[model samples]
Target: MVKFLKITAAIVILLLLFYFVFFKYRQIQANKILIPATTQTLFKINVDELYKTLAVSYLKHPSQYAGTDKNSIREKIADLNSGLRIPANIYIYALKGTAKNTLFTRLEIADTSAFNHFILKKLALLKKDAHFFESADSTFGLLVNKKTVSIAFNMAKEPIRHILEEIHDQNNMVKISDSKFAQMASLSDHLSFQDAENLSKINFTDGKIDFSSEFENKWIEPAAEPRHRMLNPESTLSFWLNGKIKSDLTEKNHTMSLSLLSKDSFFRFYQDYVDFEWTKTVTQVDTIVGYEYNDDFEQVEKKILRDRKIPSITINLNSDDKAVSNYLKSLGALDQSTGKISSAMIPLYQFYFRGSNGNVQLSTIKSAKPDVKRASSDDFFYFKVDFKKLINQTSIPLIADKLGTFSQLEIKAKSIGKNKIKLESELLFLNKDANALMQVLKVFQNGFKSALDLNLSVDIPVSK
Candidate 1:
């Protein structure tokens, strides 16, 4: 009995040692994939883990897969699994100062030959060299090595090469093992993102999408008063900002609240009331007609229709200096008799305005009044959007249909430590029991079906 007990203890110790060694090896391997310090936004995804999570979610809500070809999707997923390395991570990132259209993606390749064949079968190749290829009308470029594949979208070949070179240089890249974002990302098996100012982690569970971000800088300063109490709870969209932000819109440090009453009213205020000619340049088009007198007489000119939109938002500004209001009044934007503010240079809509206790309220709604509700006292910044109410109030079918998936979105920011702030955002879905990712998949599937139905119903005249 003593010898048996000794053998059992020895086996347990060996297993423990193996686990620690394996974990450390994975950490070292992940650290080898370096990211450039100048990267503006980065997204890390665990491919195999995400697939497993999605599979479980699908089992829980099988109804969401209705009207879709399940076999086709399974086959595609299987093909991807065969080409990429399992239990590894893929990174998608954007660099600072680069165009918004440019993006970079890096993935671990399990089999180089298989991945190369997979790419060739999927994309419409525009050009190809030894190990480099351009596809999708030259908008996408791919560089495949033995163990890794790097892809760049909307980027030239030279720039992609330069970034690849920089990533291999230790001094030019960030140390992934020491990065806070990397540590947070490793905690979750799904997806995580890091940007210049913030590191965020996303989790899908409990029937809602929970996203949390940690700010690198003190973006939200502590407020002197509970300014959140000044916002109306019935507003479709409400935002509160209390910080010293240097912008042309405001000079001094102040607290501001912006509220939108309803989606219908907001759209109407912009489409029918706001004057676009004052700030926007008119787009003109030239057409060729018939030649009556000369070649120049055949030319006809017409202005293109402008579909400009601005939100019907109310602004509440609390500050010691009233320079903003004075400037508007000086420019004839505010009507002293009715206490209304109109468009600059040209009057289109007379927005309601009132001033009391050094607080200014300007809104497009005629019945706008001061109503306050204290939601939180500690949060320096808060934003909320009632998607259900907005959808119910909107006359546009497309906007209503797309936004119907979400019930509400709320975000809050508070100081966590010195020069650090925590921002938490929650998006509530209509189906409270379904997984957030499954709900998102349903949204896309339904949208595609609707588009197909619309196309089929359209009456296209047959060409003679």
Candidate 2:
């Protein structure tokens, strides 16, 4: 019970109540659960890395993890290589010989459509006094006997009396050349994000939620509002998020822009407990990042930038540097320093090669309008967005049905001695501890006067 209370800390100040360790994110961290944000990131994992991850996991070869389709190779890549480039004249074999090259060099007849069309043009040119030739083998060429036979390869057509003949085929299939498939596995076990980096987006299909919270007052009696409230009314009521309110005892002059990437309803139910009403509607979606294929076929991706005015909630911050909080304001280092990301970078970049490679990017358009206003002391700058992009999938990182409008997310677990097992679960927008999060910080704002101020700090006292 004591530990439970510590995990659910609350601090209330006059006109403001700032909860620490926003329970949503905190609880998420505890859960070690991950969700991908499909709209604002780019991931280019080498195909080899996936194969390696699965190879080391169990008795089965991990090649499958990388995106191989052949069951015979299972997790083997001994012979397959992504770096090998093929020419237009060449045909690839999925499996070894039967007839033909099984695979062949680019045959003149290979590009049947283009060849037929070319022959038509050639015939027209011949009638127009173009010279024709034949090669030593009697095949038609630019010249007669020493000429070449360069007609289109489609025997199923008229105008060109021809027989279907395959020059030769190569014996090739997805047979791995080497036995040591583990050589090409992913070296890194964990996915890392950078500082000032946002990650793993989640979506709540319907009635999904999102939220952040902080805990305060671990020692106070359960649910006992912290002591800051009596001194600063603004601190206990409205949070700086809605609109800043004043409190003589509270620190002032602050600026902050926080983002919550989650299923629209990740924390909605919690807000419900607090009687907080929130709304979200996607106004406009702009595609920002698209692929510019280089000569090598490597993609130079442009990031997507979306302009969304989370309307209803006021955009009150003076950017990050100029702040209303004395602590933040006094810092000269907090200048309008630009970080790495910008207009050129792709915002919502995701790669899907599990079946076939695909890309999707979306930006928020300027046409979007959003407004958030606290009707009275009871209201906060509260809004909800189901950031979950349902790929018709319930699985992570894998879109199950390429043809269907859904994505599957499958959670798997393993105990050292237990057989590999997959689990089924669905995420929703409800917070079991929402009442605890709202208890963090409340806000009271008067557009004319500055809003309240309350410093929230969350400290966890248990070992997971």
Give the number of the best model, judged by lDDT: 1
Q: Model 2: per-residue lDDT, tens digit, 159-266?
A: 221111222221121211121212212112122111112222121222222222122212112111111111112111112222222233233443332211122211
lDDT of the structure predicted as candidate 2: 0.24
Location of the lowest summed lDDT over 10 successive residues in candidate 1: 271-280
Best by TM-score: 1
Candidate 1 lDDT over 339-359, as tens digits, reads 665544223334567655445
Pairs that collide, model 1: none
What lDDT does each candidate get? 0.58, 0.24
**Residue ranges of candidate 2 with Cα displaced over 4 Å:** 1-240, 243-346, 349-363, 370-373, 377-464
